[model samples]
Target: MATALSEEELDNEDYYSLLNVRREASSEELKAAYRRLCMLYHPDKHRDPELKSQAERLFNLVHQAYEVLSDPQTRAIYDIYGKRGLEMEGWEVVERRRTPAEIREEFERLQREREERRLQQRTNPKFSSRGIRPGLTTVLARNLDKNTVGYLQWRWGIQSAMNTSIVRDTKTSHFTVALQLGIPHSFALISYQHKFQDDDQTRVKGSLKAGFFGTVVEYGAERKISRHSVLGAAVSVGVPQGVSLKVKLNRASQTYFFPIHLTDQLLPSAMFYATVGPLVVYFAMHRLIIKPYLRAQKEKELEKQRESAATDVLQKKQEAESAVRLMQESVRRIIEAEESRMGLIIVNAWYGKFVNDKSRKSEKVKVIDVTVPLQCLVKDSKLILTEASKAGLPGFYDPCVGEEKNLKVLYQFRGVLHQVMVLDSEALRIPKQSHRIDTDG
Candidate 1:
């Protein structure tokens, strides 16, 4: 049978229907029903692809229903709290003789905690920058004789200009104030200096620096260029002398500093240089840092989705098993009521062909007949029918390995006779007979 149930159907499943047993069935009866169902729907017995798939699914459902209904404790829990109740942690507490009120309180507490966590996650930020360090840099430089200049710089935030630094120099012993602006593809920096040197040739010096696309240019009454290439240049102006330009070119293994003085004594100097080079540092950072981080995040999300899917499947299975139990109880009640009212009863039922030493071509298929056996089993006082294997009856055999079969019961109440059909594995329930008085009689 293709017994895969939808979500709603699983919630309403009848365990009795799944096991084909009465609600009042004893443990032995339940086990027998489970075994029979297992044999009928075992995936290995089906040859068709679709039927085998369905059998595998149905086989799992049968096992689940049997596991719950067969356990005394779990079955009791299921009867009261249902699928959701069985999932509670208090189930273990039940074994320690905890009161129902205590168990309920614990469940409520867990629910509240879960809700609070969810709300906190939604209302609060997922990512925060509290107490996080921003940026850091260290510089070390030595002057010609014994003089040295070095500093440590630190800045924080992308849009804000916040920085603190400590400077060391022989001729100057004063603090510096700086402002900076950074955006995508561009950045700018401005700084004011107050030197405490005795000369005071330039006590207050200001500098402005800007860069775009790896090309940096600076000015402080003297123009400088830190080009995308390995060459750097700075221009300085003197009072008596004209303009003096200094260029530094970095080669594979050495750096050449060329200072050309274009005073009133020399000719004007104009220079132009350009080259295309690879952004190896940027590519290396993406390969080593950003790419791996993004990949890890994607894998984590995929794992979470897989876990959620597994949880959903498990919940559906539990609901399906619970549905079967409910259905069994319903059918059991119906059978008991029919039997108590002295209504029709089922005897031997046949669902396949019957051969009577007859013609070779004669065959019966897809039909059930129980008229003769029911007539013989009925009594004037009372009727009783014990559950038996449907295939054990004479002139009966399973037609196909995974084919569905049903039973036809011959019933008579008062003087009206009727035939009712039901799944061969289902409990029998007879319809109520209506009595009418004849005017002539």
Candidate 2:
């Protein structure tokens, strides 16, 4: 029986190519080739630091290849299964043939181990923390009179913890420094603002500010009314005590505000005002003209997504049925060939199913029977020469970007069983000799 192997050990390295020798080279020839390559790539032969580093890496790979190919038992395993076969611990040669079920169980076990390892890596603190990012922003604006103002801001991560500096020069010179901390739900800020006027009335004004607030220096509270609307209020107490009430309706892009101010005197006098005459007209136009247009667009997008999902489901079902029909016909032909004394027999094969990208919410995958393609290839060499598009198999769709496609095959040759894995069907060629070694004997 074959032993368990780790996913990392399932490599496709060509040991013979590394040693510059043929696949059928004898043990002596393997050793001689290893020695020659080892001497040429040995780190000790290089003096430059970068060159030495590269040489050391090459030397390590060469050493590992030689170690496996030099041992008689391991070499036999390598000849069939390549790197993955030797990786199986306690693996031993057996006289009995392995069944398809047993081979499939072994593959499933390796897949489970790989998934576990991936989850562990994702949850590791060091790995998760590597995503923290830093950013900087600067903005400058000028009027027709050439009065200019600008600000520089720096932020860390996605939170409100940031630093900002502002400078302005017009009829007055203004400079401000601000710092914010904590998150958007609850945050605080400290700011210092200074303004200097140079005219008939030369005046200097400044304020030292501190608040648990929103934005750079405004203290406010807001509530989301719906998917697109909000209501909020802010109050600033200073020489001119002020109170502001804001309402955003229809969509957040449009807003209306009411401001009330009180003078700090013995008899406090209050004044109320609104600067939304033009904005009132704008909002009216938006509601009457833009809202319906935007709503229609949103509905169209949703309908498109639903149609796309339905189409994908239909396509997959049809493909699966077609693949099954093709497989049945191919199997019949293979049976006829075998009865006529042709040297071909059915083995094991696996084909994964295609899934809708929109419906893929997890890592689970579904596979179907694909032993038919392998069976057909055995009888007609021309079958292996077809394009990837016309390989006449089901579930051979190109994976979405960032995803990988793989095919696993098991076959018997010369009374010996073998297994192989192909990464993608981009090149629908027969499995090469390098992929024909049986890792699980």
Candidate 3:
């Protein structure tokens, strides 16, 4: 029920839809869209009172969406947590850096917790709703100064108990000491973890737990053998229950548990999730979610890096423009010569990053018309660029700076429309029938 509400809330409002723009639209794109919409719906532009009022409303909405989505900070929150995030309180404190998916996860968790509390309120007295988890729900209270939290828990049908724990969280490990009453069976756990990389790409862990029932010690080591799966083994010993070993093969949230008893007295048990229990869950989550989130974050970082180097890129673009200016006279001569005798005429040429999709892209996409440069390169009704980067050419620039590039050409060979796309580091040979854009060859 809570999950459904959260999903519904997520789909509620979209700023991109209001702006009639893609979510990936840049700041310049947002401004252009806002201006265009503003011009079309300026209220004063309409003569009829009803039409003016309607335009006013639309203009207000467009302005509001533009205001929220234009600011970088608010836009980031809007992108991650939706429109409500812009109005939410805790989000104001942007102290910690988090990914979009991470922020969404936190926001959803808070919403779920809030829903749980709401359910708690309308239930037990009227018994209308039983909360989310069905059991004794969640956190009763917490003292942040002392780093302690209290919990009331219920088991089976009627078993009830309560406990309070003070926690210590550090960079490397977590320690918690809990005190319980009412038929208390004192329990404690200690874990050790060693990591090879700073980001914890490879790790080994061991833990010991002691309770009224028995004392159990577990030892395990896990390594990520592939992007999707982790290879790990754990050996555990319990005083009364005996010893067992487990081999865990976990990949993309699919869990495999194998438990093999080391002692004959212990008997054969399930093969998975021994002491490697929590670790398997971690890897499953990392593979299924964390990988994609990290990849997206990396792309964002690269974009930011590119933005920071805009000055250098701009300078290079100026140089390329100057080179193009120098070749304009020769290019015009080539075009006239081609048109005079039905030779290949460079109709239009764009050099830079391009998408594979057939839909029209934003005007702000990193692309520049290199028609002049390309026209000058044409010879004998054919244009052939060498097997090297075109960026080093006299009249070409790396429009996208640090990104892969493509050369899209629309040319008329024997007065027929034809187009070809050539990759940045690949050779280009044109005037071929494969690039024809007409029914008649």
Stretches of model 3 off by over 4 angstroms after superposition: 1-283, 287-289, 355-361
Residue 224, model 2: Cα distance from true site in angstroms:
30
**lDDT accuracy of residue 208 in candidate 1:** 45
lDDT of 1 by residue, 1-441 (tens): 312223432243445545655556678988976885676567786676866776677778788878877876666655556666567785685745654455566667787566544533332211123565544433222222222222223334442232222222234433222322333323344434445434213343444444453322222211111111243445444333445556565655677877776563223342121110112433475479745765676566545544444555455434434333333433354445546765544433455433445643544543444333333323432333334434322123334222356665555444445455556555454433432223365
Flag regions of model 1 displaced more than 4 Å. 1-10, 95-417, 420-441
TM-score of each: 0.26, 0.26, 0.40
Pairs that collide, model 3: 257-271, 257-272, 258-271, 258-272, 259-270, 259-271
Q: What's each prediction's clash count?
A: 8, 2, 6
Q: Candidate 2: which pairs clash? A: 80-437, 81-437
- State in Å the error of residue 221, model 1: 99
Model 2 spans with C-alpha error above 4 angstroms: 1-307, 326-330, 336-346, 353-365, 381-402, 439-441
Candidate 1 TM-score, C-alpha based: 0.26
lDDT of 2 by residue, 104-131 (tens): 4565678656654553333221101235
Q: Give the alpha carbon lDDT tens digit for every residue of 302-362 in model 3.
A: 6676666667667657756755654565678788899998999988988877755563475
Ranking by lDDT: 3, 2, 1
Better of 1 and 3 by lDDT: 3
Name the candidate, 2 or 3, with the larger lDDT value: 3
- Top model number, TM-score: 3
